[model samples]
Target chain A: MRRHILTYLLFAVVTFVTWSQDTTAVSTGRHITPVRPSTNVVKQPGRDVSPELIEQYISGDTLAAERKAREDSIRRSYPRYPMMTSLWLGVNFIDPILMAMGQDYASVDVHATLNMWNRVQPTVEVGMGWGKTTPEGMNFTYRAKPSPYVKLGANYNFLFKSTPDHQAFVGLRAGFSTFKYDVDAHYSNSYWQEQTDFTLRGEGSHAWWGEVVAGLKVKIARQWSLGWTARWHHLFSCKDSEHSQAWYIPGYGPRGRALAFTVSAYYTLPLSLDRWPRKDSNYSAIR
Target chain B: MPLAWFYGSGTTKQVTVGNVTVYAIGAPGDTVLVNNQSVNELSLPLRVSTDRTQWCLTFMTTDSLFVTDTLTLAYRPIEYFASVECGAMYVFDLQQVTSTHNVIDSVLVTQPHVTNVEQVNLRIYVPTAQQ
Candidate 1:
């Protein structure tokens, strides 16, 4: 009977020890929350609160106020100014270099523009062109004397929100020219087996065209800039002689539709300084 | 004058008749028969070639016995802007025209220049009585 009691006691002891080891292993595998003592107490019914929640609410409000203050300071720094106007004079450099090639055409153009609020520029260009060409395979000689032409246009600067010292623009122009041309050629009919020499002279021939232009300008000095523009020209109308066509137009370039490129240098002159925004003025904006 | 000012220098050549059946001849398949392309009701718009100075147009009648005629035109293509919307086009100045006297009695150059102005430029006189 004593042996039986001892066996039963040993079985109970082994079962209790194994259960304690399993409980210890499960507790160690899980994340344990440390008990911290609460310093603040909430007086709400059936609710308990700590000091960390109140401190977090206070910090969130403080951060929002700081963000608002920073935005207000940025707004105060950049302010809008009143509309201002300036004048610019520019000369195209590509025509002179093209004239040296002796390909029967040359042009020199000078432009004047009014820059308004550094956004829109209204402009007018005047130029003189002349050329003479005798094509190699053709039995014809064409000559055009120096004639004057004019173009009126407006350009909208895309970089108006940036610095005034740099500009990227797109523009439209309407050009007109009246000039004279002389053509000496021989007309031959193969079926008729006849050749006739003819000389045609055209005076006061007028040509008109429209252009879409894109350009960029960069400030090189305090009041000087360097610029380049590409233009796509569409010929609208041209008055020609009965047997002759105008080979070259003064400001309109070739007699047909063409793409033209020009490099220019510009000088800006301030006519009225009072109308311009002061550099140190608080209301002066970059645009 | 305002309409002319708006259309600019681009003009198109239109061929029409008061009371006549006109069919433009084209070669389909292996045979060179009348291709049955009709331009009688609505006038046909002709486009000039960019490289060639001449345009050949052949016409056939729609009667029981078809009579065919060929007209050749010599012109100079002038590049000009038709309108702000149309962009650009070639306007032709009629220099000379020759036609075969088959069913067509005579051909008249009513307008010497052709543009995009939508007007009848050539007048074809066909025989009033058909065989």
Candidate 2:
């Protein structure tokens, strides 16, 4: 009876051990749900992003600091200085060509300008102009001698932020000229049986005018440039003689409002190149 | 309309008078006798003849003593298309001008070429006493 009882106890222990192992397996299985095969799902490629780079992009303070650094670098490239002067010798090609066509006009000018900040250019121009016109079948012959004139003005470049080699600008000028003119008119009256010839002279007559100018300048080489300007001139006042009005006012062109055109080649003499700050790599992108 | 401008000598200002009469030389019946005429202000619309190359204008003064003066203008008729709406008009370029010495002492062609632009092309010099 004792052996039978021992056998029963060992069998019961074995059954209990099997039952506990099964329960443990079932509990572990209950934690995991069955995954079905999804035909409609798609997988996208993942980008490898570093934590440091992400932090830098999200931070506003980092962006502001970088922008300030770039601005400071650009400001250091173009330093402010005193007057930077440049002298230019120019000519009006149109006037001389028109003179050949019997329109009778010619002008030559010299210019000096102070370039400030590569933005504002204050200029002074001195020129001599002369013209004569005798209309066909007219008894009068009008003549104007070469006379010197002066203009003071400033030009504002629209492309100030770009390279200094090229400029598109609009300018204003106040001009004055003192000139001499002569008019000879001859008339014959058949009915009166009389003939008369009269000569009128206007000496040392002064004229004042204003001009609105638009021009383009392109650099052909180092210290050399080609430019053309169109001007609309308005006469303010003109001194007239007793017998006749001044037919042409040297720099002013005609007696009234006139349009003038000029094409010029410039030889720039940079007066203070070493004194002014040089352009740096930042503006090299525009060049 | 085709028009031409005339002015008195010495100035471009309009000269006002009490009475004046204008007549075409060949067509004596066609006359415009204006009372209180403004000489410089008048924009004369010239009549061109197909048969003749010259136009004659006679001016009569209605003062205490009636005085007359004649002006002859020789021109070349130019036919050009001014615009679509304007169709065509005759533009005259004065070749020669002659005036009778009476009230008008002399005449000068300041601008021989005339266009639609309003300008003083002829400067008529009247006698000092008449002026």
Candidate 3:
């Protein structure tokens, strides 16, 4: 009888011990059910984790830092400049030279351009023009009064990423003028041996045109640059052409053609944007 | 071009005029366009400076009689743009035409619109008995 009682007592103690262990696990928020071991499935971590995963995380962070450092070094290779780079005031000399040589048409123009981030240049040009021509192999003698014209345009430099000392650029322009002109044309009849002359005049006339320009601007001296641009133009609308075309189109050179050229000398005027620290690179003291 | 067709017994046909002479009157030397030629068709040019044109036509008949007629034409000159290469030219719209009836019977205004393209713009008919 005593042996049976001892066996019952031991069973009661074992039952109580199992019940307390399950209750402790429940309070601690641990799973009572066994979890399947899988490499893909993620479980709530305990205090201990494999060292392999910890090593992977440390190496990954180091690799990210190294990649960022390499990228930053490569980026510093080019220039780092701000917007509103500089301003240029220029005067064209080609037309005046042509006029002095007794050419038919001439123009005198002064231009201003604002350089932005060494990439874009917004420009404006104002000028006066005149012409007189007894064109070779033609019957007409053409003449034009001194007229004023204006051109507005923008340029894109191909070498914007490089130094601003030399630039290669292509631009587009919209030009306008108000001008007056006259033409005297004589024709002789072969059959009657009679010559007749027609006198034509155009006044209060306005003309608008477009131009595609390409040029090279090179630094010739400190704060001075010499630039040459070739302009191919198309006359969009001209009130003078309906009566008689203006022989000279002020900023546009001669009428009835599509091409002209300009060689200009420029003086740089640095603005507040140019006050940035430029000593970091070989920038040639452009400001 | 003004097409002058001969009509005999109500049939329109080509009949060559004999000893044809045509000249522009107002020009400096009376520019002779066709100097005594036998022709079935002729093309005439107009003056650019004025709206009126005068032509003197002299032709011989079958009976060997020379008949002289004066053709007066008035038009509205239009300044026409031809092409970029050829520039501009003057074209005309025939408004009124009058002719002296010597051997010519009547003048019909066929097509009044004038262009550089070659087409008949006037019809000159000689008398049926003369034809």
TM-score of chain B of each: 0.59, 0.70, 0.85
Find the candidate with the highest DockQ and give its number: 3
Please write out the lDDT profile of model 1 over residues B77-119, one tens digit for every residue: 5544332233334467777766787756666676767766776
Fnat per model, in the order shown: 0.00, 0.00, 0.10
- Of the two candidates 1 and 3, the one with more favorable DockQ, higher being better, is 3
Q: Model 2, stretches more than 4 Å misplaced? A: A1-87, A202-204, A271-287, B1-131
lDDT of 2 by residue, A12-58 (tens): 99999999999998877677656877865765422333444345546
What does candidate 1's lDDT look like per residue over A17-75, in tens digits? 99999999988897887876694566542122234444544578757555655554454
Model 3, residue A275: distance off in Å is 5.4
What is the CAPRI rating of model 2's predicted complex?
Answer: incorrect
* Candidate 3 local lDDT, B23-82, one digit each (tens): 878777677888899776667667767788788889887778888999888998654433
TM-score (0 to 1) for chain B of model 1? 0.59
Write model 3 residue lDDT over A170-219, tens digit each, in one string.
99999999988766666544654546666665545788999999999998
For model 3, state the Cα shift of residue B52 in Å.
Answer: 2.6
The estimated TM-scores of all candidates read 0.51, 0.52, 0.65
